[model samples]
Target: MNDKHFDKIKNNDGFIAALDQSGGSTPKALAAYGVPETAYSNDDEMFKLVHDMRTRIITSPAFSSEKILGAILFEQTMDREIEGKYTGDYLADKGVVPFLKVDKGLAEKENGVQMMKPIHDLDETLRRANERHIFGTKMRSVIHEPNEEGIKAVVDQQFDIAKRIIEAGLVPIIEPEVDINSSDKEKCEDMLKEEILKHLNELSSDQLVMLKLTIPTKANLYKELIEHPNVVRVVALSGGYSRDEANEKLKENDGLIASFSRALASDLHADQSDAEFNQSLQKAVDSIHDASVNKK
Candidate 1:
């Protein structure tokens, strides 16, 4: 695992864990699974979670590999109250980077106009980045079926958002999730790609970090990006589905999947045991990996 191949993981495919609350639990979990960093969304529990994860991500057996435990922190999902100074102090001493999901989130209505509100205050986000100066973030750069104005909006926002986040010293992963639940797979494929190319074409080297693609079976074509000409980092989407659906997506490359409600929510819907649940999920990914290799 010299530095060269380690660089292949720039964003393409490798395991990424969504550690919603149990960041501390990832060291053992990742080691046992033979995966990469486990991510946590900085929410009400971040102080406890980040503290635990930052410690283990460094000491974990995989540290030499440079794949630390990571998380997706959106002010909405993580915590809106975490200010810049507080985050900076915490992350710097821990010596780990976090992926902030930078969404202004929904706007707060004021007067007759809507006031833009980021999930966590960008001021705080910048503060956190400045403190340790090595954090990562994911920004939503595009959406589905956009009209001319919509496409323009995507391109315009990337430039503005990236500029601010970079000033704060954070790595940004761009997520332009195209809707995947289309009535027909073929139409969905064409639209998905057209939308992807549009935003990608507009991205400046500094504005776009990693391209996050939706890996649901909108059509198997959606899965083709696993080999798409564009080598941006791709993350799987929920697709308004179940855990089985998400694990199925992981089949492409065990290293390139994101587990959301589908992964953890299985416990809520099924009577399966922990071991049984994992085995079933592993089996799906194994099958997908085999197929992906065979296709090549």
Candidate 2:
């Protein structure tokens, strides 16, 4: 692990940029950026277009470390180049820590939740990420309703993978996202918190992890998790919320910072002029930064 990048993540007062939209989410991301599905004919072309969009964001002057502490990249993005440098190296050079999304998307819903599909060749993937100067990894699972058995399974699966990631010399952002629109969102949050604490307590004092969760329906619901000895930092996912709504909810929870994806790119468009695009991105960065560092 890079000590400098670790220190920055531990001490920085900025939000993480969730630019890790994978194959499944890329189309929606591109459409939001004003690129239609018709623009790309095949998987290669589709990935290329998404890569171009990410490149533009990474290169933008507004997307600086001043308000963006880290960026999570899709595996492809990590392997790609930005201005002649590999994505991870470029992010580190710009003082923004780089993380890779390592999971192979979620499995079908079962027991009222969607667990991550098996990650084949995880060790090899970690080796490549480390080679590229990536600092950490993020994987996700989904919780639909407040099913105790299912939620426990989700948390168990996350922690299990997280241990492997840690052994490979990378911090893992453990995300067991409870659907925002779930009828029992608060119940799920409560149960999820309990399960997380159980696992966190089992970790050795030196073992550290990060948590990326849905912004809880109850304010300060994760206060304990944020202060847990085994936790480095706790961040909130947008979970389909608009930027404004996410920021508002984030402000209600003091220690939790933002790691938003769709919300972060909501204002950007592929056709915008350089000046307009930068301006819009700057607005997003500034708002999220404020919600992250300047608590209400």
Candidate 3:
């Protein structure tokens, strides 16, 4: 692990940029950026378009480590280049830590939850990420309702994978997102928290992990999780919230910082001039940064 990057993540007052939209979410992300499905004929073309979008965001003067401590990248993005440098190297050069999304998307819904599909050749992916200078990894599972058995399974699967990631020398961001639209969202959050604490307690003092969670329905519901000795940092996902709503909710939670994807790109369009693009991105970054570092 890069100690400097580790220290920055530990101490920086900034939010992480979630640029890790993979096969499942890429189309939505592209469409939001004003690129339609008709623009891409194949997966290669689609990925290229998204890569261009990400490159624009990464190279923008507004996207700096000063207010953006880290960036979570899709595996393809990590493999690609930004201005002739590998994405991870480019990010690190710009003083931003790089994290790779390691999940192979979620499995079919079962027991009111969607667990991550098996990550085939995960060790190989981790090897490549490490070679590319990735600082950490993020994997996600989803809780659709308050099913205690299912939530426990989700958390168990996450922690099990996290240990492997840690042994390979990369911090893991365990993301068990509770669907914001669920009727019992708050109950789901509560159940999820309990399961997470159980696993966190089992970790050795030296085992540090990060968490990327959906913003809870109740403000500061994760206060104990944030303060857990085994946790390095706790971050919030926008989870379909608009930028304004996410920021408002974020400010109500003191220690949780943002790791927003859709919300971060909500104002950007592919056709916008560089000046306009940078301005919009800057505004979003500034708002998220304030919400991250300043509590209400």
TM-score, per-candidate, Cα-based = 0.53, 0.99, 0.99
Clashing residue pair totals per candidate (backbone < 3 A)? 13, 0, 0
Determine which window of 10 residues in candidate 2 has minimal summed lDDT. 3-12
- The order by descending lDDT is 3, 2, 1
lDDT of 3 by residue, 250-291 (tens): 999989999999899999999999999999999999999999
Better of 1 and 3 by TM-score: 3
The regions of model 2 sitting more than 4 angstroms off are none
Candidate 2 TM-score versus the reference: 0.99
Q: Tally clashes: model 1.
A: 13
Better of 1 and 3 by lDDT: 3
lDDT of 1 by residue, 136-170 (tens): 66655334443444544554555456557655655
Worst 10 residues of 3 by lDDT: 1-10
**Model 3 ranges with Cα > 4 A deviation:** none
Error in Å for residue 105 of model 3: 0.4
Mark the regions of model 1 whose C-alpha exceeds 4 Å error after superposition: 1-13, 19-69, 74-97, 107-120, 132-134, 140-148, 182-189, 195-199, 202-208, 216-232, 250-256, 259-265, 268-296
Task: Give the alpha carbon lDDT tens digit for every residue of 209-267 in model 2.
Answer: 99999999999999999999889899999999999999999999989999999999999
**Number of the predicted model whose lDDT against the real structure is largest:** 3
User: For residue 230, what is the lDDT in candidate 1?
Assistant: 40
